[model samples]
Structure formats: C-alpha cells, structure tokens
Target chain A: MTSGYKDLSITVEFRGGAELLFEKKKNELNLPGDEEWTLRRLLFWIRDNLLKDRPELFLLGDTVRPGILVLVNDEDWELLGQGEYKLKPRDTVLFISTLHGG
Target chain B: MCSVNDAEFETDDELMQPDEVPQTEGAICKKCNENNAEVVLRVKDTYCSTCFLAASTHKFRATIGKSKLVRPTDSILIGHSGKAGSTVLLHLIKAGMSEAVHKRLMYKTTVLYVDDGAVLGQTVDQRKSTISAIREQVHGLGFTGYAVSLNESLHSSEPKIYPLDEEAEDLKGDSDVVDLFNAVSSYTSKEELLHKLRQKLLISVARSLGCCKVFTADGATDLAITILSNIALGRGAQLPLDVGFVDSRELDIKILRPMRDFTRKELIYYLNFHKLETIQTPGLTTKKEPYTSIQKLTEKFVTELNTEFSGTVSAIFRTGEKLSIGNLEASNLIETCALCRAQLDTVFTNTSSLQATEFSKLISAEGPKGNIGKAAFELKKFPCVIDAAENVPLRDSKNCDNCSCSKGKEKFEMSAKNFEKYLCYGCRLIFKDLDKQHSIPDFLQNSVRQRISLDDMREEIADFLL
Candidate 1:
C-alpha cells in the first residue's frame, strides 16, 4: 500500500521545468513519502488554475504535505493541530510556492 | 432543453483573419465556431477568440451590473494579474469614467501589485525589468500603482539577522532600485524591519489614499469569495462609503470586483479577441510550493462542484442576490457586536446571496453572554483578510555599497545546501493514476499530428461549457 496517514492517502507527483518545482528541505521535516507533484499534471494544473505563485507547498518525495504556509478554507492547520490535522472531504487547497524571491 | 433552429453552415476555411484567430499551442482552434461547428477540424477545450469575448463580456457586465449600484467616485484597488484580468480592469476603468471624471477619479484608482522579489525565480534583474514595464502600464492607463509587497517577502528577510541561506545570490545589479532594496535589508530586529516596511506599503500608501469605496477586478473565482465573505460577515463587514483620500482605517476600504462575473477562461478569451497583449509570462509555469493535503482536497471539491453545476455555483456568495434578483441589495445593519461594545460595534453582516435553506440561520444567530460566547465573539475577527497597505523596504544591492541597509533593510541571501534530496518526477509517477499522470498514454504514442475533427471539437466545447 502507498504510504498514507491513518485513513487518508491520495497519490500525486511533481514536474520540473520552467519554474523551480524542486526545493531542498531539511531532513526529518514533518512529511510522508518523497515524490513531489508530477510533471505534466503540475504544469497543466498551473496553466489551468491561474494561481498566484508563492512557496505554496512541499513535495517531500513526490507526495503533497501541509508545510506550505498559506491556509486553505481559511483554517490554519497549525491552529487546527498541524500535520496531524484531518481533512474533511471538499476542503479546497491552494498551492503558492515558497521559493518566490530571496 | 430547448430545441434549436436550423444552424447555418460555413465551408470557408478562412472565417477569421489571422488576427482574429486565437492561438494556444499553435493550432487552428476556431473551426468549431457556431457557424462552422457542424464540420470537422475543431480543437478541444479551446474557444474561437470571438466566442470567448462575447461570453466573458456578457458575464462581466451582467455580474458587475447585477445590482447596477456602483457609483462614480468609488476608489478601487486593482489586483492586476498582468493578463486578461488587468485588461478588463483597465477597460472597465476606462469605460466607467470619462476624462473629466477620470481626473476626478485618478486618486480614486490605486493599483496593487505583489511582486515576489527573487523567490518567483525573478532575479533582482528580472524584478528590475518589471518596474519599468509596470511604469509603462501606469503611464498608459494614467493611474497610480502602489507596489504592494514582494508578496512572499515578509518573514523571509534580514539574512544577516539569520544566517544567510548559503545558496543566496549577492550579485547586485545597478539601478537606484538596488539602493532602496538594500536600505530595507539593513534592519536587525524583525519587528522593527516589519514596521518600516509597513510605512512604505501595507497601511500607508494606497489604502490610506481613499476615495469612497475600494474596488478590484477580482474576477469570477475571487468574486465568488467576495460574495461569500458578505454572507459570512453581513453588515458587521459593511465598509464605509465616504472614504476620504487619506484614511488609515484598513476596514474603511470597501472592495468591489467588476469582473467577478467572468471566469478566467472567459476573461482570457475576451482579452485575446480585443487584441490586448498582456505582460508576458516567459518561462515554464510551475509551482514552487507544492500543495498540501487540504489544498488538494479543497481544489478537488471546488472543481467537482463547478463542473457538475451550471448556475448557482457562486451561490454561497451571492445567495441573497440570486434570491432577490430584482430586489435592492439589503444589508442588515446590526448595531454592535452584542458581546463587544467595548470594541467598535462589529457587524455580523450577511450578503444578498444567502441561500434560503440556511438564510435565516446566518443572519440572526445570537450568542449567549457567557464566557464561551465572549470567546466566540472574539473569534469573529478571524477570517480572510488582506491588508490593503502592504510594504517592501528596498535596499541597495550589496554590490552597490552606497545603498542603505542600515535603515532597516537587512541583507538577505540563500546558499544552496546539499539537503536537496527532494523527490524527482520518476518517483512521483508510481503513486498517481494512469490518467492523472503527466506522461502520454501508450495508445497515443504513435498517433499522427493533424487538424482535430468536428465531433471532438463539440464535445470539448460542451464539456468546458459545463
């Protein structure tokens, strides 16, 4: 079985070109799996969604995680208990990258 | 569904001039026009430039004019996307006010731009190139633009304060821009650094220079949120109408979105049809910050709803507006936060678009006077808010020692550490579905590249329309 939290796991991946889709996070950061967002899908979604760029999310081994600091659905999971936070179906997540400008 | 009449047919291959044709992947996507829709050679998920224009303009006008209550003197903040959104914002600004009236409204128009300094892969040089371009845009439009922030700039500044990211580049380019940049980079205390930034950005410049109300081209998706905000906040969020040219009250800014009625897809089409060249986004589009689980979940949820439903998609936002189509928009003016009279009376205002089922629930919900209620009362202040006054402390490039980093601008840098053991795309492919994966299907590996057929075009249109 793919690595997942207690009861939730959705597969996703990363693509790398054009923008800096790749970032080096510290070891032992609070995340599971290593793959980032998939290539074609990530590019397509970026084109499709018209999102503003920011250090939106973290791709720890091709999987998605909550390290990206902006809150979706107006809930700061840090306030909602961080990485252990459970997601109800239908919550919207936005990805703004963190590697915006130094 | 209503039955349609006999549709006209056009066999002419050249219905539109080269200028009229919209290019997206460098293909002839216009063969599916209503006049020529029956024939083959149409593309998928694409629109002929003209059709896209009609749909967006109709949507923008209908939605912005839904209440037709927008007055002339209203000061609006334009969050430009440098694309069709900015075009529409400019067009609407041009259309709504005349030269004489525009002079009156010049101070009323403030453009907010959030350039993410170097993080967006925009080198300081690229960022420098942009100011001139943006200056040209302001000059062309004859309006003032307030640089909001290096969007992701805060919390990431003052490298000397923190050990600099070893990978950070320090090759400073020439231009007074570097000096301003370094001046801001010189601060030691994060709190003080942040305050100095606020002086130039968030609270001081744009929002303070108020008109009557604040407006944005928040187009459809965000428009949906603006409407929802009202439904959630009600008259408690009722912004003041008489905004003098300079007021420090952040909430005093009333935001109106003219293009919230139009979708991005529709807006793009409208801009292309009218021959508007947007600020070009060169390079590949990629996400730097990967999405979190909540973000993915929320996106899927919103997409499913948008795809499945036709109307009422933005219902939560404009519920009352939808319910009272022809009715004058009504905002219940609650006098005070029943709990916090010590604070300014906060409104628990509702929008005109509250759905009937939960309509009464949101507007009249009362809180007990107990401690729990008091805590809940305090919670009301927490919500989606953007400080219209955002700032950036520009300092001179370290290359130019003549700049002022000592005045609060901290020297920033990021050296690439070898911890870059992030996942590559190959590893990610294992988790995704065959369809969702970015790779091409085996079946299409040997397909010939040719003009698309008609049936395929219709399906694409119908699906996008849905």
Candidate 2:
C-alpha cells in the first residue's frame, strides 16, 4: 500500500458543536492519492471544500484549533503522529470540540 | 573548542520538540496488557474499550463513594444541560444503578433541564424543540425529567414545572428575561446574571422536588476555568464552595460535582466508547468570540494551555482543592448575600480594600459645589448628616399623617443603594450593572425586606434587660 499512490477513501466526523462550523456531522470523501497524503494535507483540503463558515473556529495555522481533539479511528491522534500521520484507506477521523459549555 | 567563549554555541533543539508519539499499531492495553488498545489518553496512556469503560466507571463511582455524602434513600436531581459531560454522567449513573444484586446504587435519580433559550434569543418554536429533544434523551434513560423556563425567575409565585413527556404552554409574550438581558450593560455582566439566575432556579426546583442533593457535571477543566474567572470577578471569598465537590451555599440543599475528576476529553472518549450521542446546546457565548466575556476568555486560555501542557488543568484544580473555608467560625452565623446566597463579604477592617474603594469614590465623585476640599470634609461627616436627614423625613411623615409620605410607614421599598448593602462585594458589582434594582427576582427582594424588618425590630429592643 505504501509503494505507489492510489485513491483513498475516508470518513470524517464532527461532534460537540464542532459540526456547527462544518454544517454537517459527518463526511465521506475520496482523496486522490497522487502523493502520500498526511493529516496536515487533509485538513487544508477539508477547509477548502467542506468547511462552511468560521474557518478560524476549526483551523489554527497548520493544525486543527487547540481546543479541538482529533482522533484517528477512535484513537487519539497524539498517539499516532498528530498531523504528520500518513493517511491510509478507510481511515476514520473524528474532530470533537471541547470549547462548548457543559 | 579552543575556549568556552570561542566555541560555537550549540543548543539541543530536540528538547523543545513535542513529545514523541507512541506506536499504536499492535499495542496492548496498558491496564489489562492482553486486549488490543484502541484509545489513547493523556498523551501516551493507552487502553482497550473494556478497560477504558471499566476505569471510567470506577472513577465515577469512587468519586461519589469516597465522599460518603449520599444516603441510600436520598434523592439526587441531575442538572442535565444536554451536553457531553452531563450525558456521560447520566450514563454512568444508569450503569451503576443497574448493576447486579448488592452493587446497585439505591439512591433515586431525577433529571432537570432549565431552558435558557430566552436569554440566547431563541424563538418559542426553537425552545420547544430543544425541550423535546432533552425530554427524549432524559426519558430514554428511564429517569423522571422536568423542564422549566428561566424567565420564571421574574414571577412572584413559584415557577411552573412541566413533566418532560407532557407539553408545556408557551409563556405569553412575556419578554421579562429578554428585557433583563437587554438592560445589562456588558456581555460579562449578562453572563454573570444568567449564571446566578440559573443557580437560584436550580436550588428552588431541587427543594420543591424534595431532593437533598443536586448533581452537576462540571469537569476538571470547567472547574479550573471557574476558579480563575470567579477570582477575576471578585468572588475570591466564595471560591472554595463554588469549585468544591459539595456546594452547601443553600444551607439545606447541597450541589455536588461527581464528574469533577474527569476532563472534557475523557468524557468524550467515554461517550464514544459506549456509542452514546450527546445533544449540542447553545450557551450565552456559543457563537461569540472567546474574548467576549471573562468566563469565555478564561475557558479559552485554560483549554489552550492544557493542549500545550497537559497538566495545566489538573495543577489548577489541585490548587483549588487546597482552598477551604471550614475554619471560619462566623461562616454559619454571618448574614449571606441577597443575590447569590454566599456569605456576605461586605464587612471589612478599617484599613481594607472596601473602605479604600469607598474613600476613592467619595473623593472622585462630582462634589456638591464642585470643590474637592468641601467634598472631602462633607464625606468625613456625611454619615451623621445623612442619618439626621433621613430621620427628619420620618419624623415629618409621622406628624403629617395626611401627606403621601406617610405611605412609607406601611411598606418598605428597597432602593438600589439600600439593596446593594445586603449584597457581597461581587454581587454589588452585578447589582450596579443592572438598569433597575427592581428587576431582581422577587424572592431576593422579599428576603432583603424581611431581613431589614428583623434588623429594625432588634434595634427597637436594644435597651432591654440582658
């Protein structure tokens, strides 16, 4: 799988009011893997295509906002290389916002 | 390196880099060491779903169990906001109560959702829909649920409570809550007012429900932010009770934070593990910028700091845990604030901040004759002068019975100046921000009036024997 570039399918989900910025809770996308895709590249792609409004609420600089937690396949992205982790086929990425009031 | 100064200066750049990520491909659970790990917490700790759920449940139970505060028969009203923290709390409670045989919790649980959509500028239909969603989630757990409007705080009578499954009549175009928020000057004060009102309403509903304790799902990060924001808001004296596990401010009913040990990240993980969905509820600063209010700014600061340094929130929470008001002998005997029900912090020594602030206000005020010299002199003797001036009006009213001033003898009207004297230092600031003093809830005004009469009665009998 790591030898050559190919198309990759992934699911992205948002929760805890983070969906407000995306206008939807979940997305299924086909990323054209012309080159090795990293989470860093996917974030910018999503910002360009999927994010509806208030892009600042979702992204800060080159990574997701500070208060937002990014999980890859239900595992904290911190355990995997946060933004540098290479995307694999059928990976599930979840963004949960901890900024909302209890 | 010929000499220390001549050598090129070298620094270890790797030391400043972020912590290394542990490989998760085939990792075993840190707890059980058998099952494949699926969840990562606190940067590096990994756990499987079963182990993670078990640990979380144990933490929740241990938090309440170690306190030994709840009796087997005591009723607890869960203050559900339809958010993640409370949703996880409710799930934990259900799991504990459904345990086999002797392990089951015997205490009864009821849920309450105080709808503050009015303050958030939601229409009647939006508010109703939100209530309906809450009702479904709450009733799905097989617990009794009640919904009440926040505007009920403006009524003189008890607030009307509606069963979750039943429909509640739309409040008749009464814009009291909206008007109250509009009258507030700044978003900071408006948020403060909303918090105080919600707390007051919660206590009243808990009392009516005969629940001895109220459960709130304030996580560690939330409490840390509260600690900092409350201190900034001049509520330093009440910090212990406000962030502590048990808040006994009401004297009769105590509020408990069972999920105080969990962080927002942990709460979300637990929910995701159980496949339990949480409803998104908008708050006062939901869509507003983080700098809009002190509370929001503090929350943003703490959450960001925690992201950079994971121990930031726990350190602040540990510092808050060290605070205690238990040694104050006068805490029970002292008068409380009229608004927040906190012990009054108005009494100060002669050389204190309160006196200094009053002195500053006096000197800074526009003088009666625009003379600073005369103003200072008048302020020094102003207490006796004001008392004499007040007594003259009473004496004249007593003699001139035919005048409209005599009406003051029958009833007492709490003026903003007099009402502020009954509040604590922090509440006084909020009262000052209010456009009208009469806009305060009727229960607070009634309490102040009752206290005033009691003080008057004591003064009348000062010379009695003993």
* TM-score of every candidate: 0.37, 0.88
At residue B286, candidate 1 shows an lDDT of 31
For model 1, residues B412-453, the per-residue Cα lDDT tens digits are 221111001111121111112222223221111111001111
In candidate 2, what are the lDDT values of residues B1-466, reduced to their tens digit? 5555523445666234544555665567899999878777776788988999999998988899889998878999889888889989998888888867347787888889988888888888888888888888887766778888888766656777788888867655448888888888777888888888888888888888898999999999889999999999988889988899999898899999999999888998898888888878667787788888999999989987777677789999999999886444554457889888988876655566766777678777766556777766666555456556654444343333533343544455555666676888888887777787336666777777666656555656768938
Query: What CA RMSD would you report for each candidate?
Result: 25.1, 4.8
Quote model 2's TM-score for chain B.
Answer: 0.87
Clashes of each: 89, 0
* TM-score, chain B, each candidate: 0.41, 0.87
Question: Candidate 2, chain A: TM-score?
Answer: 0.92
Where model 1 places Cα greater than 4 Å from the true spot, the runs are A1-102, B1-55, B58-69, B73-77, B81-83, B95-110, B116-123, B137-144, B148-204, B223-252, B280-297, B308-312, B315-466
Worst 10 residues of 2 chain B by lDDT: B397-406
Please give the TM-score for the first chain of candidate 1: 0.33
